[model samples]
Target: MALTRQVISTLQDNGTDIMGPDVMAYHYPDASIISGSLLTVEANHFAVLKSRGAVLGVYDTGQYPIQTPDKPLLGGFVTGFFGGNSPWQYEVLYVNRAKLLVRASGVATSAEMAEMVYQVDYYIHVDSKDDALKLTTHMPFSGHYIKADEVASYAAPVVEQAINQVVQVTPMEKINEHIHEVVELLKEHMSAFLSVFGITLNDAKVLILPKDDRMRELISLRAFGLSELDAVRYYTALKMAERGLVSAPNMAVGAPFSIGGATMGTYPVPDGHASVTLPKG
Candidate 1:
């Protein structure tokens, strides 16, 4: 969502007050648009403002009336999106009448004008959060057309679902002990498996395996007996090998060993240990 604070700030900075329709014809007779007819007048103006890299404000000014030379003139800010590639501009023209008038202008075609009117109506009457989000991200213009209730209603369920999905198990000694046991079991299995293939384990706990070995066959075999935790660790080592983080006979010096499988696969073990896959039937 665009920050409300920035929207308000932008409005305050650029908002303007103009005389209503009655006064505009006399004051600026050359002006092409009239204020009171709801045909081509702007009733109010709003601007979206940004501050400190975040949207901070949306400022709105009071509506005013528009009248002819004989009638009293009313004044208010004009609200709408202006100066874009689109032929139609969205605006509300302030008039002497009590009711607000939303109008679209910029084209002589009736269909185009009708489309603009529809747009204005949609903006003023619709309560769509998705539309609001889209406008905030794409539109350069700004106003307070969005309602607070719409946003709250749309976001509440999503937030609740996220909170509900969070796992909250208590960390305990049993959990740690189980993890250690799985690590040790994996280590033993890997050592024995590597021995059959002439691979060896170093003091650092790295399993040195031949490049030509059937790594995938070995991995599939070991994966069968591994607890969830050990499987995670073994998968992680395999990933490291694929990324060239582990050493192998065929790889360039200091390059990681190459293996095959999902990148994020993990074995059920703590950090700082390695395992090698054994052949399967």
Candidate 2:
């Protein structure tokens, strides 16, 4: 009678990285193989097979029969000579083609202000599968994890350097006002830095807020969608109001009001009539 046997279940596959961000080095567990057992390796992935301590072959993107007859002459000879019915042990490992996400966000300091404290947020991912495998080989890992931060660490120093270079030379006046310009400058260096590890930055953003509450209020005055000159005019109006040079809201109609800096003089009164008008603040 014909009978069927199984190695690994088809249900074992899921998109989750077998080696997560915290776990780096791992190989698939050994499994028993029979003549017609299933061996399926998905597309855009690598399945490295090994016997004993030596790699037998790297397979990808195909279904295959794992039969004794399919084995090389030397391998078959060794198996036959080893004696009775010892289970054939094989190591099959996988590497992925999917991109991995990396994010870095923090306040970077500049020599200009002990630290010109500004915030930055960046999103990035590994650009190449080949490079990621090489990274896995080079990094230290005891079992299954390497830190997510360790994978993206190549970009952090670049970010700091970019911030330092751009912020140090920038005039203190424009540093907080034109942060987008600083981010653009940083991108030039970051692009090259990320390329080394086959990584790419995506939809990254930068924001600079005033550390002082007073300065923040000064900035919020532009909420009216005003042009720069209009903002200046609005600001001047606020200052005038604060100084009491502007009139009170309940002032009588047609009453004359003089601004604090204005030169006021009494006009010679006409004999027939007296006239008065409200003054603009």
Candidate 3:
């Protein structure tokens, strides 16, 4: 096909900060490329041409005037000419190169976690150009909704599996201490798991989603480094405040005694003994 019109095309991204707060998307219609076609791609953007679900070529920032003498038409209008150059049909997808934030979760399988749900906040980004293997393996596209599995299918599941493993071995009381360790482990594993998708795990965050009010209280207690006694004291204070009774000084004095006494015999002993013993005598 011979080029006929002044074809003007520019990389169009729905400003990542405002429009695509959560996703990477392109809003441009597919176009026919001629030798004189105007193309302007900016930094932090990857312009890609794909035919039949296969990526043909990847272009970087700057202007590109399509050279079509040797490039044959994939399939499109016949009459198209640009600076005496023929046209070729291809779909263009503008990929956002910036790192993205995503959230993923999985149901815990361990019997100990029967009442809690595990969640992970993760960061993912495209692999560096220097990695020859990732250049070929990583998924070409990311999904729009972190809530949806579309773009996060592989990455999310891999992260969820990693988190579940960590949570299984970790005591609920000390889970926060090992969160960084779990994130580091995920980084190493996802390098291989997500290689086929050409993405990398940049960062990860782990959290326990509580199942009930009690679980919530427990989590809050742990977060604030509060003993159960202290938590009860604070809770009682809140309730008392709600009822509009007792001044702060009086509540403070009454709180510790109430919580301490109420919790005295409630503490559990070791499985083997009700009290400390001096040993066989």
Candidate 4:
């Protein structure tokens, strides 16, 4: 003879969009849901029912009655019940389908061997049922909710790796000048990398900066009447001379620098004797 069982008549999410921008997934408190229970899923959300790590079904923005005919998993009954509860056991996880902003920062080495700090602001979202399943399956969250910072934490290393790849081939002096190009490449690489986790990269903004203040000052010379080419040539010569790659006499005022077999014209240095006048700061 079959014993009596307790049934949860209704399962609903009252705190729908209230999850806000920080939350990614919300875990339903009850895992013992029986057939014929009404599951209310809010808009812009996915209600995923799972049994022992297996996804039984994904419901979007509607009320669903947990019936055995529709879901075969609901047919199996868990026996040896102490309390008058149904043998069926399942967990429902609500995934937020909204686009979320995630920010990540890291340090990368430039082609010039300069340590550059980088930050990326990106937008991501889980669009389909498959995306929601992958997210719930792969990214396990503790407690009741998974937050955006958790996603940011996972993205930080990936973003850094992508930034390193871009900057490692780009010289420090020209990094800022080609920042848009860098951002595009980062978006491309990061999009592919994040796709594995069921997240889509909508857009991203990347900012790269030299780790040293002196390097920043050197690159800023372009704002003070110096051309981009002249700024690179000037900073290159200074770095080379500092490293003893160029002789002291070759660094004198009006002395040209021969870099990569090409002659670069003189750069005026502030040593109490220079022809070009610079704006006083």
TM-score of 3: 0.62
Candidate 1 lDDT, tens digit per residue, 194-249?
23322232211112121223433344535488654555456655655788764432
Model 1 whole-model lDDT (C-alpha atoms): 0.28
Preferred candidate (lDDT higher): 2 or 3: 3
RMSD of each: 26.3, 11.9, 9.4, 10.8
Q: What is the lDDT of residue 90 in candidate 1?
A: 26
- Residue 263, candidate 3: C-alpha displacement in angstroms: 21
Clashes of each: 44, 9, 13, 2
Per-residue lDDT for 1-281 in model 3, tens only? 34453343342355333224354434236455545555555566556655445656667766676554434532343334343333345555555556777677766533366455767776766544323123333434333212214456656677767767776777665666776777777777766785665566677667765556665665675578777777666665666578885443344444222232342112235784453312221
| Candidate of highest TM-score | 4
Off by over 4 Å in 3: 1-21, 25-28, 51-56, 69-88, 106-111, 127-149, 219-237, 244-281
Report the candidate with higher TM-score, 2 versus 4: 4
lDDT per prediction? 0.28, 0.52, 0.54, 0.73
The C-alpha stretches of model 2 lying farther than 4 A from their native spots are 1-96, 110-129, 171-173, 176-181, 200-203, 210-281
Q: What's model 4's lDDT at 188?
A: 80
Question: Higher TM-score: candidate 1 or 4?
Answer: 4
On lDDT, the candidate that comes out on top is 4
Candidate 4, residue 241: Cα displacement in angstroms equals: 29
lDDT of 2 by residue, 1-281 (tens): 12245554222457444554333224555454445666665554455555554555555567766654423333445457643233456655554444445555445444346344555566555445455444444454434334456544656777767776766666444666567677887777777766564456564566655455544454566555665555555664565467785443213122344656563322335674653333343
- The regions of model 1 sitting more than 4 angstroms off are 1-36, 39-162, 165-226, 243-281
* TM-scores of all predicted structures: 0.21, 0.49, 0.62, 0.68
